[model samples]
Target chain A: MSGTFYGLGVGPGDPELITLKAWRIISHAPVIAYPAANGNESLARKIAAPFIPEDVTELAIPVPMRREREPAQEAYDEAAKLIARHLDDGKDVAFLCEGDPLFYGSFAYLLDRLAGKHPTVIVPGITSITACAAQIGRPLAARNDILKVLPGTLDAERLKQEITGADAVAIMKVGQHFEKIRGVLTELGLAERATIIEKATREDERITRLADVPAGERPYFSTILIYQGSEAW
Target chain B: MSGTFYGLGVGPGDPELITLKAWRIISHAPVIAYPAANGNESLARKIAAPFIPEDVTELAIPVPMRREREPAQEAYDEAAKLIARHLDDGKDVAFLCEGDPLFYGSFAYLLDRLAGKHPTVIVPGITSITACAAQIGRPLAARNDILKVLPGTLDAERLKQEITGADAVAIMKVGQHFEKIRGVLTELGLAERATIIEKATREDERITRLADVPAGERPYFSTILIYQGSEAW
Candidate 1:
């Protein structure tokens, strides 16, 4: 019997944010896999550690975070093959992902290679965008409002145009590019309404105004959201 | 001593999609409030029913869905006053929401009145957008790809502008305006790549290519997601 491959999204930092379906599948799966880089622990596995069983087989796919600097094509290629072995033996394997699997998540790479060849299921998780919006205690957008999610890696000029055209904006992957992103928001007079959320839904979560966060190194797990038209506190 | 007010998102249609945090708070809450319309049972309340205690007090705010025919302000006002009484008595109240509460949810109206006056916390939920994307087994947007969330209620021209300007789009609230939205997607040559998902993540969920759904009444819990570069199945 060929086994099923489950792509489970364990959600953001908090373990409690994981859904019931994800928890159930994770706790009972015969084998599990998650992304790791440079021997660092996978955030997805950490968020799900409380629910994962004690005896399940574990595999780590070394997916480099900085894909631009170090291509990880060969690593993913090898990981998919190893995963196939477990499935061929009729052992179900659950691939854990941080956040929603298909929303800018690393799981997409694995899914692309495996979905076409086997029975696969993608279980969605809560997004950090919604988590940040929840932490802000304000609606991201209302009726007929436009929401633009632009990557911070975009050229500053294009970023500006996209930000200017939307009613609510969430800029992802805002690592060291915080200053440039903030500058664009400042130019658009949205600096005050903007919020920098780090590790949202976690115990040590920090929320600050864009103006207050110093221009320096930012945490890898961070996002900038602006609900324009509201006066800054 | 006043108690905290929790605005929890129970997630889309699947009961298991509710987060552990939401379940914990809802189960322990002294009073539970949810939005109901025209005597129809509240979807949020239904999603959380398995976790809710039998002895807990339930408050149904009759928020009419037909805002054009019957404004909902008066109903919300009355509900707020009733909720305030619970807060005034130092009893913790948990307000349940269908999707993410801060993302175009009915809970926003209550939060607008209670947020500043009382200590409130917003617990985010799994968005239907991400759920639908996961069901389709494709990335919503990756790398520098732009994601635009445009409401189907927008004027045809504005909806067209927003849809054309992004690499990926999720058209929400696709009720009676399905024809217009479908027309725009067809004009943009994206109909072949679009997927209509109803009640994602739940039993009896339906996923269909946008071009194949016959001309008929679309479900309110449905959304149309289009990944511009892909072909529809």
Candidate 2:
């Protein structure tokens, strides 16, 4: 019998956002897999720590983000090989992802490689956009409205066009692109309506209007939500 | 002291999808407010059952859907009055919503009325689109791709135009308009690329290729995900 591989979403920051199915899988799986940087603790593993059994074998696949495509591809290929070896040993493995595995998650790369060789199940979790919007006391979009969720990694012109066209927009990964995204929103006359959230749902969470944020202090995990309507107030 | 109003998203169906922040508010709030139909239990309240404390007060505000504007507006006014009465007592209240409170949620009606008078917090939960995509092992969109989340309530011709223009699209609230939305997808030559998910992530979850679903079995909770790119496969 082929061992099952579970791609579990641990949710955005808050540990309790994990689904019942994911919690159950983590507790019962004989082997647990988490992505980490070299010599770093896995964020997903830590979030799932309370549910993970002490007896389960823990495997950390170090996948460093690289500017070069070859290194990243090689890392994914190696991680798939490692996971395959564990599956061959007949141990059910649970791979922990911070949010929905299929939503900009690294697990997709591994799943593509392990297709048909193993049984896989994906457990969805609360996405960061919704979590951020919740903390700020704003609805993402109302009835008959359009919602566009995009990464801040896109170019400023494209981001501006997309933001201007959307009824509500959630720009994620607002790391270094903070100023660029802010400029785009400003150009589209949406800066005043935008809210910034950092480390949402966590104890250290901060919510502030985008116009109030100082330029030098923006964090990588921060997200900007723009509701392009006067009624948002 | 001013009483706080909580907009808690109960998630799609699974109780565990509710965030820890939402669970905390639901447990400690003096009153739990939910939308219902003539004293029926709210679906949001039921999904939140596992986390709601035994001592928490339950307040059901029946907001029936109506074809006419007068009845719907009247329902919103009545619901607002009930929530205001609880706030007058200086008691914290939690209003339960099934999905993200801001995403086509009826809570918007109450929020419009109650926000200025009370301190309101919105707790975001998992939306069905992400849940559906996860269950089917499909990506919502890739890097720099345009994703449009539309409602089936839109006219079929407009929906068809948007579907054709978007790299990926999620058609929501496919109730009486299932056939119309299906027709739009077909007209855009996207029938084979679309996937239908009903009651996603729930025990009753059903996923089918858009072209293969039986005509008579479509439900209100069903949503169609369409990705036009050939690379989606």
Best by DockQ: 1
How well is each residue in B63-178 modelled by candidate 1, as lDDT tens digits? 87863523467777888898989998999999999878988677777888788888998888988898898888888876557999988888889888877768889989898889
Candidate 1, residue B179: how far the Cα is off, in Å: 0.7
Q: After superposition, how far is residue B136 of candidate 1 from its true place, in Å?
A: 1.8
Instruction: lDDT for model 2, please.
Output: 0.79
* Interface quality of candidate 1 as DockQ: 0.61
Q: How well is candidate 2 docked (DockQ)?
A: 0.49
Count of backbone collisions in candidate 2: 0
Q: Which pairs of residues collide in candidate 2?
A: none
List the lowest-lDDT window of 10 residues for candidate 2 chain B: B65-74
Task: Write down the lDDT of every candidate, Cα atoms only.
Answer: 0.84, 0.79
Model 2: CA > 4 A from native: A66-71, A215-218, A229-233, B20-30, B38-41, B50-56, B66-71, B215-218, B228-233
i-RMS, every candidate? 3.3, 3.0
